[model samples]
Target: MQQVFFRLLGPPEIYYNDQPIRIPRRRSRALLYYMVSTHTPQPRERLMNLLCGDMDDESARRAFKTMLAEVRSQLRNIDPSIEWITNDEDRLTFNPLAPIWLDTEIFEKATANRQSNLSLAIKLYRNNFLDGFFLKGSPDFDAWAQSTRDHFQRLYMLALQNMAEVYETNHQLEEAITCIHMLLTADPLSEDAHAHLMRLYWQTGDRTQALRQYERLGKVLAEEFSVQPLATTQELYRQIASNANTLTQPATPLDRTVHPPDPPLQATAETPVVEVRLPYVGRVRELNWLKDQLLGHEHERSMLMLRGEIGIGKTRLLQEMIEGYCTDWRILHATCQEAESKNHYHPLTEALRSELNRQDIGRLELYPVWRAQLERLVPDLFYTGATDNTVDAHHNYTGFEHISDSSATLLADALVALLNQLATPQHPILLLLDDVQWCDKGTLGLLAHLARYVHRREVFILLMYSPGSGEQRLAALRNNATRLGILAEVELEPLSRADIHELVTLFSQLNKPGDRRLHTIDRHISGDWCYQQSEGNPFYALAWLETVWDQPETFVPARIQEQVTIQLGQLSQNARHLLQLAACQQDSFDLAQLGSQLGFTLATTLDACTELITQRLVVADPVTTTSLYTFTHKTARTYITGSMNRIERHMLTQTASRIADPEAIS
Candidate 1:
């Protein structure tokens, strides 16, 4: 028996006994491709509508029947013994048990199980789905085909990424480079793939190639998106450039190549610590204020809230303050993760665990009763000989019993006592909670309790969170702390253009001494363009500068545009659509104009715009007579426009262009 093979990844084709079989009609080929790709029973009416919707209903029915007949006739001629299409009264499906192979099916199966046959999957994705096979007058079929093409492309890219990571981990530098190169070819604007390729080149002892890759990435980004590389990517490039010689140097061959014996590990009381190394750029005043409050003679306990936008350096500032000012204090730090928000008292539990692990448990002698109560929170602390009898019987009796106010109060008091027992006047405690916006309600309540009693102890609490995210909860906590004279709020503003220039200059001087490249870069660097592009956000500025600094000419890099797109991708579909519509209005668009174009009410538009403002994607003009808003950066506007397909852009542009007459409103 001869096998039948169908190729649908590119142009649809079939082969019988290694001989090509002609698929005569465009509609017949499309029908075959759709049936094979979907691999399920498709309603005959739906298929007809998708393929021949532009025709009259009777004509479309006839076209669909004729197309199905042609497809069946071609299959039967190729393989008379095999059942190809299973036709019924209302639906049509390809026979699953037929002795036929499809490129799309094989590619999908291989990519789906890519962990085992990633190389094979990568090889099987020969081209885009049904490449150059457009059914004229069939918009629905074209749309479906385009979407399917994008899906398969993403899968292929993911497979390549996975293969690269695996190769890099196994120290297969050349193979990793090959995989990343292919990924970049598939999606040239992928900053991540470019970064990986740069790193792989550096690891393979090719410093020049690494530097060239960065330069090429910047050039490509500039040409394609009129944007610079991301600050993170630029920073990586800088690191590679600065340590080129060190990175490229070949390792000395070992004399005997003897494997060293595994050393015996000693048990220690200290938990391993992860040090955060963020560049300390701005926030001098904030740091100074925190230092004074933390180290001042005022005996009252203080709570300082460091609030800012994401990547605006709140966490970095906190880390710097701890290292610079809180050296003499015993610090217990915990970061509330977004994923673990549902875990009650998560941040508090982490802080307690870290503190307990750092200290000798035998030294602190708690009352048998308090020890048992503490065990309720930290079960592992007394894991060896602890009993569950400490749990209140009444609390556990009802399986879903709500924690009573008194029980919560008791738990908070026990937590505070544990902190007090660990701290003294000689060694004050600094409890640092990072990303407090994600902290659970129970953790916030515990902190509130601690704030009320903090005046009696030498402990200082530091909470860091993005301002807009946890507004209501943080405001409530702030009010309580303010009433107690224990709260201080610090809002971090974006760096001034001069400040950004200073930061860039400092980094360049430290890393690339005596290099004249800074002079050329600094000329463009001191302009308002960089400041506006970055919105004075240090992270954004750094990212923008790193990519454009090498080139004397100014152009927006791909990294900057991609970053905005990535941020937008995280928003709700409605919010994202609203912003995209807003982008079509160009610079400094009025809310009324946008609402008019979208056919949305003024209030609904305002609500969506508020989300965009909070994200720092757009900024409302404070001095405008009308309600004017613009994207925070031109790069963002460009990114939004570039992300849309031709049809979407045309539709949005036409709608926005029609709103020439501004509506007057109160």
Candidate 2:
């Protein structure tokens, strides 16, 4: 005899001869549900319509055939005599001639006998209907499905109350009280949960707190649900309040085992392969320093915060750090999004998820620990059970409360759990947070908290942020470090001439190593070139060198001059107008003042500064007394003054003249 059962309330466990089997796929499961729900054979067209309401005839027929074939294969495996197809003209019906034990059927049959079978029915309907199957915009189905689903939910609640009732009848106060707490956690708003908790509290000799729970529930219901307690719940509350005497009796044995239905089978998505190339030259000392900070130490927690202006090789430096340092550590990296900043805990969380899914720590014995930690980072991700969706859904984080809170104490706890599980002498943890400036508040707070205990633990966290951020904001962090005396700072300055030369040699593919011309150009680069033009910034210098090398013809001084001139010359007229306004004041022009001076729109002024950055003419120093644009090369500032036409020069001077503090220096 085949014993089929519906367990839909708790963890789903299926047993066939005490062996576990993978649940059948969706189409097969739906077919089974339909077959069990209907007494007669469903018409072929009707089945097709239900499965594919608007698909063309061929598609619907194909889907219907596939589902039937799958259903037949599964049933045949379990019982060879049971078949899905018995053709009656053009219609199809499932032929289950033998007696079948269906969960819903048993539930209905048991519920018919209120006194004896209610507990059995409650135990039978454990989880919600079709636990993991989502109905797509089918209102009628949703309504009908919800009614049945709620029936199970209601019965489960009653089962807990039944436990309480039986325990109370036996005067098993402790057991009954435990059930009440479980009910409350499952549903804080449950009137039954509140009433049961109140009764338990009173019985436990906490009568005052019990009365408070009632008062709290009254206020909560009034403000939120806008309703009084149900008559049955109120009666229970009154009975608890009125009675102080306890009755003692023998305990009744009750079976609490429940099995929720199987969840959907998930497919793992492909992960993007991230490749990093080590720099040919620059910051060798910094690279070694990073290695020491991240990998050299054997026992202490470590952290490094990489900070510099844009195009200053911060990212490149980090790439080098990862490549050269902490190979033994399980490294995880996440990047922040400018657009996603408003969304809060978006890209950071998503990045963490992607890194987790891509991890191949399967054989490391620390896999379970690592997985537990990863799940804490993204609880919803593991539930998907497939890589592609796991990675993709994280990247597309929808800003749910569950995901946002995952990175908090919960995430920390998970990480600690994972670490404890691994407890390896060799393996350590390394996490890199990119674009710290754009990180959400929750992530920032968690990191700060982690920083406190990270030294004691075997973890390293590295953060990279844009320079020139407010002192009030970042300074406090540094001050805290000093006060705690547990943190260190490494500031990155621009590359030296020798460093730049090494970089040029590393990236350069000159015809001859002994080429005098290459040497001549390298020699021409004085300290001023890096300090001003490159601003000691490696990326800026590299971009400059590349731009010079990519002329229409071979590199010539004339061509280099022309290219540089053209880039400096193409600033929007309004941008130049704003720049002149900025230059006239004490090196900084407030947006309103610049707007009024140049008659330039706020959008135009902002766009012009962005263009200036692209042209490498100005930099947006995010820090300092004022966040303003400045000439990339001081020499370029000189040219701006020298090359201007007489009228333009006069206009700039005139704009400068009107300011209260004309030379508004930062």
TM agreement with the true structure for every prediction: 0.52, 0.44
Q: What residue runs in model 1 are displaced by over 4 Å at the alpha carbon?
A: 1-279, 299-301, 358-361, 365-370, 385-402, 455-457, 513-524, 527-529, 548-570, 661-666
The clash tally of candidate 1 reads 7
What local lDDT score does residue 504 receive in model 2, on the 0 to 100 scale?
58
The TM-score measured for candidate 2 stands at 0.44
Tens digit per residue, CA lDDT, model 2, 1-666: 756443433443444555654545655555566555443445676566556554688987887788788867766677776554577887676565644555655665564443566557656655666565644632333333443454445445555566666777788988887766655554567665676667667777888777778887788889997998666556655665776465222111121112122221111111111122325466777777777666554524355677755455666776565556545656566666445656645644654454443223232232222333344345443432211111334334442343322124334444544434433447666666665666665556556555666534466667766542221234555556556654556767778877766655654454257665455556664434434455565654554454433233222233224434545455777766666556555544464566666666778766776656555556655555675656655534544565568898887777777665557632
Model 2 ranges off by over 4 Å: 1-280, 298-301, 358-380, 384-391, 399-408, 415-424, 454-457, 469-486, 509-532, 549-580, 583-650, 653-666
lDDT of 1: 0.68
Scanning candidate 2 in windows of ten residues, the lowest lDDT window is 265-274
Global lDDT scores for all candidate models:
0.68, 0.54
Residue lDDT tens for model 1, 484-520: 8878777888887777766766656654655554555
Model 2 scores what on Cα lDDT? 0.54
